[model samples]
Target: MCSNVIRRMNEQQLIDGCKRNDRLAQKELYDKYSRKMMGVCMRYVNDRETARDILQEGFVKLFTNVDSYLQEGPFEAWMRKVFVNSALEYLRKMDILKEAVSLDQAPEASSSFHSVLTELSAQELLTMVQELPAGFRTVFNLFAIEGYSHKEIGEMLGITESTSRSQYTRARQLLQKRIGKIL
Candidate 1:
């Protein structure tokens, strides 16, 4: 039996214990990161139930693939990537990205629009993002929040670069319109 208190285990210790298939370590890992990962899942999916499903699936994938972790980067970042990929896979399986459109000229958000975003509370911003249609939300999260390039998002979602750009643009426009109502 693992003698270390799960709560006291550092990240590296957790990773090592998980790699050794210690149940306490796995539970601690999940307890430590599940909420954050759930937020990541929720950003992609609107409903909590679906987000929970994705969160569970992400944890399963993480534990299964723990041995593959190279320890070269921050473990949280690596775990986040796994959860994000899991969410993307769920979206793909549901064919949610099929609605994404392609536009040759995607307009950028104005400087004033960005300033408006800064005025909102984090919950308000999150709610606005959650209200976006799935395609827009997914693209926006990938391009803006996750810091993935349009080309990278395109490759990940199996859409063209123009489509990713178009979705991101549309998402921003929608969010701006929503924010305008609050001002």
Candidate 2:
């Protein structure tokens, strides 16, 4: 298919350039993937400043590990996995991400992220989330935004599932307050 051909060509160029340690190629790759990857970082980090730090760290890992990326499949998925691992690692360092999140029959997400979220600019949404306190925001973003199960959040954060759920509950409350203020 024409799409496959285009993807192959783009990846091939970037892969070859990466193999040669070309800084420009590295920058180009970062430019292309940073936004999505930052979204990953933000899910695990409660602070926008810390999220940016994690984003930068993830890009460094991507650039250095570019050679390790498999040539056979979807590049974005691979990049996402890398960013996710990096975000988890960052949470581990912070010690707060270890709280257990409880799912306990929470309601279904209010809306599909793609549809409900389209109404707000990315910055506005991020700002709304960033307003949440640290522990609450991290759990909320991981569960609500990134679609991680509460059990998964619990394992990642070193907390009980119930705690993750509680944090998520609190996060929702906080977001509601912030949204009300904005309105």
Candidate 3:
């Protein structure tokens, strides 16, 4: 039908339609970004079902706030930030970040761990990351994957920068230990 044909919009058109609360455009946008957004959610939560919830919640928030989008960056990047923040909100609600150990309790970083990581496939690496404790996984995903600084992660997660740094260090160490067994 011509209606369906008209619904196949480009990114900007989808954004415009979403801003106008167009259902077709919202569905199109969800279809386009859901998988990638789900991956982002999974990186933080690890559980598929919870990630699905976050993905849905992220879309809701994205649609609700689309009017505030400044159009200063790539639309996909903005979408990712929304999904990541949604995941962080879930984590905060669960109080998972409270499990983060202090910097004093963290182990020394292993330089050799860097070389082991280079050998892993992305899936392998992701699996190892998913195996981390919730606190460590959140910090690692934010700092390493999302490219946020510890200060920013701390501000977002309501943790201190040092706590974020320690959690990230511990995450790397745990991944290295896991990779050692696989190798």
Candidate 4:
């Protein structure tokens, strides 16, 4: 059959092919998910270069760890976890995920912040997030965007849950201030 007539493979097939070291399968997997995964990497990092580096590293980890995939969960979710972990690892190695001073404050989860978010394009919002200090950015991405609990974030970053909450609060305040200026 012609290439165009070949049936498209499912995620498992792709994973299996990758496990067998099939270059075409690996390339196909990369082509399908690189953009989305790049967005994940970029969210944690400040610049494009670092994001690209993290993306490459994440893919390498993905390929090497392909055999560990349990097939019990959504493959994309699994892939996303790998990328997020990779980004976190990069931050830790660079010492960007620092011990944040507890602000002893809570995020103002008000309609104002929501209104600002609604007004901004996704890219604009992402830019605002990227401008935050490294610790704030990491906590914000984990708690706000990724739906990770503060406890989970604390475990991931080796901080206390209270510290995670404090960082998240500070991140929201910074974002609100930046958005206020943008508005």
Worst ten-residue run, lDDT, model 1?
A: 101-110
The count of residue-pair clashes in candidate 4 stands at 0
Residues 143-174, candidate 1: write the lDDT tens digits.
89999999999899888999888788898877
Ranking by TM-score: 4, 1, 3, 2
Error of 3 at 168 (Å): 1.1
Candidate 3 per-residue lDDT over residues 26-89, each given as its tens digit: 9899988888898898888877899889988999999999998999999999999999999988
- Candidate 1 overall Cα lDDT vs. reference? 0.86
Local error of candidate 2 at residue 77 (angstroms): 2.6
> Is candidate 1 or 2 superior in TM-score?
1
Worst 10 residues of 2 by lDDT: 105-114
Clashes of 2: 14
User: Residues 1-183, candidate 4, lDDT per residue (tens digit)?
Assistant: 576455387667888999999998999899889999999999998899999999999999999999999988999999999999999999989997884535454335544767667878989889989988889999999998899999999999999999898788889887887787776
Better of 2 and 4 by lDDT: 4
Candidate with the greatest lDDT versus the true structure: 4
Candidate 2 lDDT by residue in tens digits, 1-183? 995665454766886787788877776677677877877787666567987988888888887888898666788877876787787787667765544424542233342344445566877877777666567777787788768899998987778999888788877865655554454
**Alpha carbon RMSD to native, model 2:** 6.1
Off by over 4 Å in 4: 1-4, 99-111
The Cα error of candidate 4 at residue 42, in Å, is 0.3
Give candidate 1 misplaced runs (Cα > 4 Å). 1-6, 100-111
